[model samples]
Every structure is written in structure tokens, then in C-alpha cells.
Target: MNLVRSELLKIRTTSTWWWLAIAAFLSIALAFAFNAWVANETLNGNAEELGVTGDQASAAAQAANLYTSGQYLGLMFVMLIGILMVTNEFFHQTATTTFLATPRRTSVILSKLVAASLLGIGFWLVTTLIDLAAGAVFLSANGHGTLLGEWAVQRALLLNLLAYAIWTVLGIGIGTLITNQLGAVITAAVLYLVGTQVVGLLFMLLSNLLNSEAVVKWQVIWPAIASTVMVSEGQTDFTPAWWVGALVLIGYAVVSGVAGVLITRRRDIS
Candidate 1:
């Protein structure tokens, strides 16, 4: 209990978490606004192309405004937060003190994981509310105001939150195992940014060059591929089923976390 309290204290006192939260909130807000704007523009263009004017075009635009922009920005922020959650300990030399104080390395690591997960969940909840509210307002302004049921919205929001939180915890595990701030940070960044996209492209290219349909479709089994599949809206025709994606991601998180624990327990922290 004390160890948990200590971990929470460290998290609360740090400025990094606050900065990340602010950045996440702002980024989600901007993405939603941009998506809304683009939606309105496209709808208007379509309306003009079809020779439809006024309220009809506005209504069409509103309906088209339900995009996945909020998820994109929120995920980016999640990556940043995940990187810091692990790296910050090294940057501040907190790990040494934490281990020395706690002695039981597993306890310390578990405490940190719990703290990070809670923080990630809290941040996601707040940002989701803002994202949904802002999206609704923007859509309503354009004359397409179809309010989603509270329960459905809440469920979607929770799924999003879980997805991000799991990723962050997985990152924490990576950080613990590596113990080098730079390496862990880079890995987390790559996982979120470059890793998945690179795999997706390579798979597509290989499929084109080799004329192999199975290879192209099966490539989504990679960790990066699976992560993308999990986050995408409503499973595109090319993407894996949502349950497969979810299971793959969970597998990655579990394997990485266990590996981290084993490494941390055996390592000489000094």
C-alpha cells in the first residue's frame, strides 16, 4: 500500500503528466475541428456537384461529419504519454530510489503499472468527453444533429480508453525491460508511428510484386498491423476482424509485460 502511495505521489508531483494531458486534450480538440471542417467542405462540394443547395447540403454535411479523427489524435497522445511514463523514471533517476525504497522490485513495477493505467484511463475519459461534445456541436452547427444514445457513446469511449491504456502499459513494460530512456522512448514512438504503417506498406508491396493474396491479408497479424486493426472504425474490408485485432494486441501487451518483469527482476539496478 505504501509503495502504491509512493508511486502515486511521484506521478502527481511530476509536471510531465500535466503537460501530456494538456497536449492530449488540445490535439484531440484540433483533430475533431479539422475533421469537422473537412467534412463540411466535402459535403458542400458534393452538394454543389449534385446541384443541391442550402439546407439539404448542410444536412448532408452534418451526417458526414461522424469521422474517426478524435481517435487518431487521442492515440497519438496516448503514445506520447506511454513513452514518458517509462522514460520519465530514467530521466529523473527515480528508479534507483524507488527500487531502493521498495526493495521488492515486482511491487515497485506493479505499483507503477497500476498508477500509469489509472492515469491513462482518467486522461482518456476527459478527452473523450471533449471530443464527443465538440464533434456534436460542430455537426449540429451544420444542421445534422443526430444525438447518439448515452450508453452507446459511453461504450465506444470506454473501448477507446481501454485500447490506449493497454498500449501505454505495454510501453511501461518495455521501458522496465530496457531501462534505457532513449531506447524505450524510441521503441514506443516507433510502435505508434512507424512500426504499423511500415508493415502495412511492405505487406501491400510484397503482395503486388509477388502476386500473393494470402501474404498480403495475413500480414495484419504483425503487432503493428494488429494494433491498427484494433483502432480502425468498423473494420475495413482489408483489415482483420476486430476480435482478432483485439486478441493480438492483448497478446503483445501480455508478452511484453512478462518479459519486462523478468528482465527487471534479474537486472542489476545499482
Candidate 2:
């Protein structure tokens, strides 16, 4: 309990928490802009570009999609929060003092894992509230009406929170495994922002060359897309079952976390 409290205190005392507020602002602002644009399209009778067939139901669905899509942009910020939670400790050479106080390496790592996860959830909650508020106001102003009651929207929102929380833990694990702060941070960014897209493109090229539908299904196993599959709720046919996608995501967290714990336990802190 003390270790957890200490970890939380470390985060509280630092400037890192500011990123959460920034993420919330960006998320809400972008969501509002996107919703407003969709509303414009709906009014201009060009909603067909977004697959809205000039019907109330389809328009509501399209609006819901636009509203939720912007919230995912905040995930990158939360991912940075996770990476910095541990990487910062190493960057400042504070891990030696932290270990001296705690003595037990496992306890220290576990506390960080807990702290990062909680912080991640908190970040998501704030971002989600902002998204809802901004989405409702802008969407209603644009005459699109709020679709907060839609199950798909609700699922996407909740799953988005879960995904971000897991990402923080994954960040902790990666930070622990790779002690180099810059390397760990850059690796996380590349994996999430660029690596996944590259993998998808490569897979698509291969799928075309091989002419197999199965290749598309294999894409679901990638952590980034798996998280999307868990939240997208039947909107995309290429995704696997929700359970399968969730397992794939959990598998990533577990593998990275376990590897980190093992390395932390065995490595010498200089």
C-alpha cells in the first residue's frame, strides 16, 4: 500500500499529469469539429459519402461514428502517460532511490503497474466526459441530435476506456523491460502510431497477392486492431469475435508485463 501511495505521489508531484488535461481538451475539441462537419454533410444532402442513405437512422449512426472516433485520438496521449510513468524514473536516475526505499523490486513494479492503470482509467474518464459533452452540444447544434443511447456508441466508449487503461500497463511493462527512456518512448510511439499501419498495409498487399480472405482475419490478432475490434461492435466484418480480440489484447499486456517483471527482478540497478 505504501509503495502504491508513493508511486501516486510521484505522479502527482510531477508535471506529467498536465498531459491528461491536454488530451481531454484535444479529444473534445476534435469530436466537436468532426460532429459539426458531419452535421454539415447531413444538411447538404451529401451524407452518402459517409454511408448515410438520407435516412434518420443512418444519419444518427453516422453521427455516432464521428463522435466516438475522435475520442480514440486521446489514446496516444494516454499511451505517453504510461511510457513516462516508468521511463521518467529511469531518465532522472530516481529508480535507485525508489528501490532503496521499497527494497523489493516486485513490489515496486506492481505498484507502478497499479498506478499507471489507475492513471490511465482516470485519463480516459475525463476524455470520455469531455467527448460526450462536446459531442452532444455540437451534434445537437448541427441538428444531428445526440445518439448517446445507442448501444454501439456506449460499447465503443467503454471499450475505449478499457483499451487505454491496458495501454498504460503495457507502457509500464515496456518501460521496465527497456530501461532506456528514449528507446522505450520511441518504440511505443512507433508501434502504436506507425507500426500497426505498416503491418496492415503489408498484410493487405500479401492478401492480394495470395488472393485469400483468411489473410484479412489474421489482421485481428494485431494488438492495435484487436483493441478496435473489441470496441467496434459489428461495424467491421474483418474483426474476430469480441472475446478473441479481448484475449489478444490481454495477451499483449501479460507478455510485456511478465517480461518486465522478470527483467526487473534479475537486473542490477546502478
Candidate 3:
């Protein structure tokens, strides 16, 4: 308990937490605006192209998307909270002291994992509230209503919360592996932003070259795409189901987290 408190205290006393929170907030707002625009465009276009039932499904999908808007950016910020949780110890040269106080290296990292997960949940709550408010307003104004009672919207919300917690835990794993604060942070952000797009395109190209859309299914191997797949409104043969995405992400989280803990046990803390 003390160890977790210490970790939490470390975060509480720092500017990084608030700075990241602010950035996440702004990112969420900006992302909401853009996603709203996209949702509107999608809804308008679908109404023109599809029949009644199809249009209704499209509207529901867009509503779910609106409620989960800013998800990618919000997740990116939560992940940073995790990466910094471990990297900061090295950055400040305190890993030795922490390990000495705890003696059980596993326990120390576990506390960090716990702390980061809690913080990630915090971020999820904040973002979810913001998304809900924006979604309700937009839906009501457009006469679609909030659709809050819809199973799809509810599922999206629940899955979104899970995504936040897991991503943050994964961040801790990343921090443990890299240890270099800047390297880990930059790698997390860039690889997520650029990596997802590159990987998607590469998979698409492979699928085309192979004349098999099945190749695109491999894209979920990347955590970012897997995250998207988790709350995805639609699925096709080219992509796996939502559960598959969740499983792929959880697989990465477990591998990276366990790898981090095992390495930390033997790591030189000088």
C-alpha cells in the first residue's frame, strides 16, 4: 500500500500529470469536433446511398462513433501516463531507492502497474463524460436522440473503458522495456500515429498483391489497430471481429507487461 501511495504521490507532485491531462482534454475536444464533422458527413452520405434499414444502422453507428469520439487521441494520452510512470524513475535516478525500499522488484513494478491502470481509468472517466455530453447534444439537436439505451452504444462505452485501462497497462510495459524516457515516449506516440497508418497500408498492399483480402486481417497485430477494432462499429471479412481485436491487444499487454517485470527483476538500477 505504501509503495503504491509513493508512486501515486510521485505522480501527484509532478507537473507531467496535469500537463498531460490538459493535453488530453484539448485533444478530446478537438477530436470530438472533427469526429462530429465526420459523423455528419457519413450520416448524410449514407442516407443518400442506402435504404431505410441501412440508413438506420449507419445512424446508429455514427452515434456510437460520436459517443466514442476522441478515443484514439485520448488513449494516446493515457498511454503516456503509463510510460512515464516507469521511465520517470530512471529519469530522476530513483529506481535504486525504490527497489531498495521495496526489495521485491516485482512488487515495485506491480505498484506502478496498478497506479498507471488507475490513472488510465481516471482518464477514461473524464473522456467518457465529455463524449457522452457531446454525443447527447449532437444527437438531440439532429433529432436522432442520444441512443444511450441502445446496446451498441452501451457496448462501445464499456469496451472503450476497457481499452483505456489496458492501453495504460501496456504503457507501463513499454516504459519498463525502453527505460529511456524520451525514447519510450516518442516511440509510443509516433509508432501509434504513424505506425498504424503505415501498417494498415502495408497490409492493404499485401492483400491486393496477393489477391486475398484475408491479408488485411493481420493488421490487428498492431496494438493501435487492435484498439480501433475493439470499438469498431462495423466489421468485414478483411478484419477480425471486435473480440479478436480485444484479444490481440490483451495479448500484447500481457507479453509486454510480463517481459517488463521479468526484465526489471534482473535489471541494473544504477
Best by TM-score: 3
Q: Across residues 107-185, which tens digit of lDDT does each residue of candidate 1 receive?
A: 7677767776776687767876676667777767766564454333333454566767776677677776666677776
* Best-first order by TM-score: 3, 2, 1
Model 1 lDDT at residue 50 = 48
TM-score for each candidate, following the candidate numbering: 0.78, 0.84, 0.93
Write candidate 3's Cα lDDT for 1-270 as tens digits.
787888889999999889888988898888889778767766666544433233234767778778777788888888998999999989989888888888999999889888887888888898889999988999889887888887877878888888999888889999998999999999989998999899999999999999999899999999888887888666765667778888898898788779879999988887
Q: Which ten residues in a row have the lowest lDDT in candidate 2?
A: 52-61
Kindly list the per-residue Cα lDDT of model 2 for residues 125-150, writing each as its tens digit: 77666667767876688665787787
- Candidates in order have lDDT scores of 0.64, 0.73, 0.84
Candidate of highest lDDT: 3
Clashing pairs in 2: none
Off by over 4 Å in 1: 37-68, 142-147, 150-155, 210-219, 222-228
lDDT head-to-head 2 vs 3, winner:
3
Select the stronger candidate by lDDT from 1 and 3. Answer: 3
Q: Give the TM-score of candidate 1.
A: 0.78
